[model samples]
Target: MPRKGIALVISAPSGAGKTTLVQRLLREFPQFGYSISCTTRQPRQGEVDGKDYVFLSREEFEQRRAQGYFAEWAEVHGNLYGTPLAPVKDSLQRGQDVLFDIDVQGAAQLKLSLAEAVFIFILPPSMTELERRLRSRALDDEATIERRMANARQEMLESRWYDALVINDDLDTAYDALRSVFVAASLAPFRSPDLPEALLDS
Candidate 1:
């Protein structure tokens, strides 16, 4: 039997280091492909279209949403972001694992759509650490930071829905734990079936 592809959803609070963990996991595991999200938010200074995000106009994003093109979408801070279903479906059909760095709502949507998806929640060691990381970014002012922290608390409340949780206190250790989840998921009975007869004959 052919090796089935897996979708891994990584969720976390704003400063939980989820993005950094996803980057390292992809770099170390070539078999996994990153799923680029489409968003209506303006691109930041160093962010590239299609790389950081598929930056789309508000009209375009709404049109796609109307067409049901996204597996999941949400509006935050007056900006919309969504995970396009096409690329993810294509990658899985091509026998490549797809990694989604999405929020709790998106992850829940994915679970409903793809029952085989591996949901992993990356978390900070403590709320204090989470706040420190958020402040270190220096992108938001006090009001925005406070809003984000509140959102983070909500995100934490949703962590129990995930298949696994990795506390990202140490980057290397967290990466290892995340990688192990991927490895185990790949080897699971559902994803990897018995060897084909044709191959066994050789």
Candidate 2:
């Protein structure tokens, strides 16, 4: 029996190491497919157009958004971001898991839209450590970093409703925890709709 694919949504505040954990998971589990999101923000250095994100002009983004092109979309840090709906549905129907690395806002939207998705939240060791990590990146100015810190507090507050939480205090430990969540979600009976019948037939 072919099992239905799972939608695994991993969300975290900026500098929480969610991106690194997601990358490691994808590398370890090559079968998992990544959902490249569309964004209205300018690409960061070394970020590719389609590979990293479907970078779009604000006008184009609004047009497609109005057409109901996104499964989930949110404004974060003053930028609009969205995940396409079609590819995700196609992959799930084909029994190929899709991984979404989005923020808490996007995750909440996805949950309302796709109730069965497995939602996981990543946390930094502490707010202090989180700020340290963000500053180390040197990507944002003081004001921007301050704004992200404020957002992080709200995100963490919202994270209480997530199905699982992995504290990214240690890289390897966090990866193991995140990987375990995926492994467990894969075994959920709901994802294998034919399991009971197949077992009885066997």
Candidate 3:
């Protein structure tokens, strides 16, 4: 029988290489079920609905939120983003790990509900490198870049709360570090049903 799956949460500030690492992990790890989130933002070029995000309008997002649809939800960068409870619970029930790409605020909320989830924080090597990388993307204006840098710094302060920290100085090296954590988590004894609860209660 397949074992109970774990919740894997990866969080990083914008432009800190969180997306790249998560994308690579999902591509390589077939067992992980992607937790596609619902977002109130307009779709960026090439983004697909129900795949990249659920793509809800603010009204629709709020409507669902009110109906008790979200397991955890938060507003980030002035946009509401939520992960529906149904999909995540379904994956876990099927013995497939659920992967979450979320912000620190959402991470905090998730901890209250899923205390055993594995949390990893991705960080840029330095503020200088992070600024350089953000600018290189050419996706936003200088003012927007500055705001992101500030946000990145704020998020970095919360890295202590995570189980592991991976610095994205070199992509391959960082990816390897990240994969190592997954390997270790997969081996955790808690996943084994043979370990009786009486052992813990004693």
171 Cα displacement, candidate 2 (Å) = 1.9
By summed lDDT, which 10 consecutive residues of candidate 1 come out lowest? 189-198
Q: At residue 25, what lDDT does model 1 achieve?
A: 83
Q: Estimate each model's TM-score.
A: 0.80, 0.82, 0.80
State the C-alpha lDDT per candidate.
0.87, 0.90, 0.86
Of 1 and 2, the candidate ranking higher by TM-score: 2
Cα lDDT tens digits for candidate 3, 34-69: 788899999999999989999999999999999979
Give stretches of model 3 more than 4 Å off: 36-68, 76-79, 195-202
How well is each residue in 1-202 modelled by candidate 2, as lDDT tens digits? 7777889999999999988899899899888888888999999999999999999999999999999898898887889889998888888888999888878878888888778788999999999999999999999999999999999999999998899999999899999999998899888888788998889988
Give the CA lDDT, 0 to 100, for residue 152 in model 1: 87
Candidate that scores best on lDDT: 2
Instruction: Give per-residue CA lDDT, model 1, range 1-202, as digits (tens).
Output: 5677889888988888887888788788877777888999999999999899999999999999999898889998899988888888888877888888778888998887777899999889999988898899998999989998999899889889799999999999999999999889877765555555557888
Q: Model 2, poorest ten-residue lDDT window?
A: 105-114
Error of 1 at 37 (Å): 3.9
Candidate 2 accuracy as TM-score: 0.82
